[model samples]
Target: MKKLIETIVKPLVDHPDDVRIGVEERQGRLVCSLSVHPEDMGKVIGKQGRVASAIRTVVNSAEGAGRKRVRVDIMD
Candidate 1:
């Protein structure tokens, strides 16, 4: 799960090394808190949050991600 997210966002950031993802279980769901360099936030989030939405959709639909609900949150 972590690797999937890293693969998705690394190339979109100017500071790939600064990208971090924290995984936690919350209310029976898998929560992924994603943090990226400030400058790359916009790129990861994209216009009107479209990119972020897309990412979350993928996470939710990913096979082998388990049956638990998966959430992707962009953290500042």
Candidate 2:
């Protein structure tokens, strides 16, 4: 799941090496937090958050991901 989100977000930003993702399990939920270089925040988030929304949708629909609640957080 971490890799999946990385693959989707890396190319959208100027600092691919700065993109980081952390996964944690809490209360039966899978939480994925994404952090990128400050300048790349807009690219990762996209206009009006459409890019972020799409990434969350894909992660949530993954085979095991859908079984539990999957959340994607784009962090500053």
Candidate 3:
């Protein structure tokens, strides 16, 4: 799960090396915390948050994610 988020976000950032993802499962929910270089935040988020939404959609719908509720948080 962590790898998946990293793969999706790393390419979209100017500082690929600065991208980091932390995963935790709590109360049957999978939470992913994504941290990227400050300058690359806008690119990962996209206009009107569409890119962030898309990223969440893809992660939640992935087969490996199973039936768990997934939440992806983009951190500053």
The C-alpha TM-scores of every prediction are: 0.93, 0.92, 0.91
Candidate 1 per-residue lDDT, tens place, 1-76, comes to 7888999999988999999999999999889999999999999999999999988888788834558998898998
Per-residue alpha-carbon lDDT of candidate 2 for residues 7-76, written as tens digits (9 for 90 to 100) = 8998898899999899999898888989999999998888999999999888887836338888888887
Compared with the true structure, the alpha-carbon lDDT of candidate 3 equals: 0.89
Clashing pairs in 1: none
Better of 1 and 2 by lDDT: 1
Tens-place lDDT per residue, model 3, 1-76, is 8888888998898899999888888898988989999999999999999999999988888835447898999988
Q: What RMSD does model 3 have?
A: 1.6
Could you say which candidate leads in lDDT? 1
Which number leads on TM-score? Answer: 1
Decide which is better by TM-score, 1 or 2: 1
The true-versus-predicted C-alpha distance at residue 8 of model 1, in Å, is 0.2
* Candidate 2 lDDT score at position 58: 88
Ordered from best to worst TM-score, the candidate numbers read: 1, 2, 3
lDDT over C-alpha atoms for residue 41 of model 1: 96
Cα deviation of 54, candidate 3, in Å: 0.4
lDDT of each: 0.91, 0.88, 0.89
lDDT of 3 at 52: 99
Candidate 3: lDDT of 57? 88
